[model samples]
Target chain A: MVAAVKRATQTLLLAVTGAVLLRMAAGDSYLRYVNSWMRWPLIACGAFLVALALLDVFREQGSQDDEHDAHVPRAAWLLFAPSLVFFLIAPPALGAHFAERAQSAVVPVDTSTEVDLPPLPEGDPVPVVLDEVLLRAAYDDGATLADRRLELTGFVSRDKAGTWFVTQFGMNCCAADATVMRVAASGVDAPPDDQWVRVVARHVSGTGDGGREEPEVVVEQLELIEAPKNQYR
Target chain B: MSESTRQDSPPSTSGSTARRAVGLPVQAYVVFVAMAALVMSQQWLVPRLDSPALATWSTIFVAIVVQSIPFLVGGVLLAGVIATLLSERALRRLVPASPTLGVPVAGLAGVALPGCECASVPVASSLMRRGVAPSVALTFLLAAPAVNPVVLVSTAVAFPDRPEIVLARFLASLLTAVAVGWLWLRFAGRVPILHRRSTHDHDESTAQAFLGSVRHDFIHAAGFVVLGAMIAAAINTFVPRSIIDGVAGNVVLAVAAMALFAFVVALCSEADAFVAASLSAFSDTAKLVFMVVGPAMDVKLASMESGQFGGAFALRFVPLVIGVAVLSAVGMGWWLL
Candidate 1:
């Protein structure tokens, strides 16, 4: 009778946990947090637990071997104490301290694309760059080529002499394997480091030098925005 | 009259029944709950901490667990098939005789069948039941996971800028496995627990044997994996990153910390290189230590050793492996990295 109760308890706990996790996985933001590989084991373990619980409920106790029983050590319960304390008091999120201490590896930039810039409207405040025009051209065939207004979204990566690259980190695996992608913007107000923002810019692509290639994007406007929950690409 | 006399053997019948009663349900229950609790704890603790360093740690942990599942599944299935289907004569033929040859050969052979550390325990246990030498089986258990191709490839990928680190890891782990095997053969005395069989018998048919063995190995291994992960997650949550980083630079301190990290993280050999790579703050030597010691001696491996080889044997064996792995890593790091 005691064994049956224990088995039922286990089954209930596992079912509840599995259902919660599955719901979490099916939610829109699930892909942002966990990968497909992680889901399989949890599902498998839950299934196994349910199977065992059913077996325990129906199988004759005397016929079953002691080896098949669920006997946990008293010491195992002590393992839960630390985790319980932690769940009650959540730790702080990753901060600038990590960025400061981590090795400053430079992100390699590719500079081979060409862009064409339209003339800025009379009395326009911001200067135009070449790369933005190329980016616009690539995606939209330079249609709706507006010298009046344009917009882009990314994080402030670096600030240099009136220019900054709005950057985002792309991850292939976990956060450990993240790589940075950036677009340079000039003539816009530079945001604080690592701040997420949207920028409105005049699209301008630079003409290739006779022997040199320098494609740039000139930003005409900048607006800072709130950081997303997950910062990785 | 002769048959009637033989039927009066009450003592033998009762003795066998008592042994069965004592062994079966107790082992099953202990193994099951232990496994369940351990796995569940890992699931709970990994998400709550949320530090970048912890994120890297969690990735390594997950990768190790994820990568090993296929091999573990394969090994358990194979064990089950062998146990149930293969005749005693066939099993004997399959296992190499002569401990001297078997131990070294098994250690070297680990390179060919690359798998994660989690799979090695069950495979080694299965091999032992099939008549492989304990010393050789132990050597393979230590070496195969450390020096397998998948692990080495992952290590290479993790340290893409440096090719030599991969080679260094392979050499150091191989040497460590051989050394552990030699030590075990020389000093280990009459260890009966290492060879204990709970329910495996030669009489079982292949199909029944296969299913039983697979179920047994899966439950046993999965339980320890969960236990280890829980301990790892708990440690990850409570222990500050600064504490790990504070002692990371000092040579002696770094070595000790790496050894402890190996124990705490319990990452698979293939995935550990990536974890080491992400610890860019630590010296190359420290990272080397992390790679070398992690697969050989960690919480999971210790739990597994205890479960397979008995608590007493594991108590002795784990510390010895830790000591040797640490020293070898330090020496190799100084020389190579």
Candidate 2:
């Protein structure tokens, strides 16, 4: 009976893990934890777990149960921890609170010889990712960003002095490698922390030589938007 | 099919009747149901988790566990194959008898396997189980994940500007692996870790033994990973990481802080160089220390090793690896970088 329970516990844990991976792969939820490239491995591992569980079921019924009935140790119960977490909590993604804790380091993502970015789109206001905006303002050789209205969207984070920065974390592989990117937004009252907001603004000179503060965008118009399906860039 | 169905179906008996009345056979069932209920109504947790510390904790905990599962699966599969297919005679013949000769070969051989820390734990355990020398297997265990081709390539990519950083990593990581193996050989005496050998029982068929080994290794390693991840999350939540910021400028303090940080965060070996590089405040040496100390011994590795070897083995083994790893990183940092 104990052996049967052990097999049952193993099967249940594997099945639940498989289910979690499957769900994560089929949706955007996994982006919070790992890179998008992990989708295939996640699916493959999930399938393997489910298949292993099925094999256990066959073995359990094949008359191998009665002979090896060792007492299930209490430690064996820990195997269910991930199963419980996956089924019950299914923990959420990194949020504003993590953004508040960042000093900042832009990982040099492109190792190949530096290729110039394509010419900025011509318009009154252009849509740019929060990361691209930060990268260009800091690293770009050309001053293509001068006097151009750009639209940027990210969650709101406010400093102690009642200034808000349109902030986002750029992730390379997972939340573990998440780096903070903040663009100070003026001409608008602060939105509540963690609220998704869009700002139509132009670059404002950030004269600080130190790395902490990046260029700001002066908001001409502010609009709140729903958090996107993929939270991390 | 009938037999399986019979096993799952509850027999009509007084004991089962009593269980049915109470909705379970033991008090543990009430706790399980309560946990499930708490999960269903997790709104209360959201408010408590709204704090930055808890939120970061949750994110990191989820990240580590979810990120490593595929690699752990790969490890278990490799281990299963090792247990069933690689006969003890073949393995003994394959590995050198002398620790002096075998250890370096095992360390160099680590370059081929591509896995993170968790993946190597089971494979090492299986090798030891199959009658290989403990030193050789342990050397491979540490080196395989930390110095593998995938990890080396990732390290190269992460530190492209400084080719020396990549060289320092390879040399230091391999050094740590070899040093630990030699230390184990001299210090551990002649006691081999005995995992409960259901190996004899499962030698019935290749397929059966393979599945059995897979079931055993996966369950054991994954449980410890869960436990280790929870502790890491707690440390992440309750402890302020800003303490390391103070020492980032001092070379000695920076190395110490980075090593401790590596232990605390337990970042995946393949992904850790990127993280180390991201801490731009630290020097090249500090990042080297972070990469070296992490894959060799961290919270997750500690738990996984303890799960595979005995608790006593982990207690003795981890600190030694950390010490050797720190010394090598500092020495290599001074010499190479």
Among the numbered candidates, top DockQ falls to 2
lDDT of 1 at B91: 61
Model 2 agreement with the true structure over A126-181: per-residue lDDT tens digits = 89887677666654432557777898988988766767888887776677667777
For all candidates, state DockQ relative to the true structure.
0.08, 0.34
Query: What interface RMSD does candidate 2 have?
Result: 5.9
- Please tell me how candidate 2 rates in CAPRI terms: acceptable
| Model 1 stretches astray by more than 4 angstroms | A1-34, A37-63, A67-233, B1-75, B85-94, B191-205
Q: Give fnat for candidates 1, 2 and onward, in order.
A: 0.00, 0.37
Off by over 4 Å in 2: A1-5, A60-62, A65-76, A107-119, A139-142, A160-162, A207-212, B1-53, B89-93, B198-203
Q: Per-residue alpha-carbon lDDT of model 1 for B227-307, expressed as tens digits?
A: 676566556545666788688778788878888988886766766776677565677788888898898878977886686
Question: lDDT score, residue A144, model 2?
Answer: 59
In model 2, which residue pairs have backbone atoms overlapping below 3 Å?
none
Q: Can you tell me the DockQ of model 2?
A: 0.34
Report how far off residue B72 is in candidate 2 (Å).
Answer: 0.5
| lDDT of each residue in B254-303, candidate 2, tens digit only | 98999998998787888888788778778888889999999998998998
For candidate 1 chain A, the 10 contiguous residues with the lowest summed lDDT are A206-215
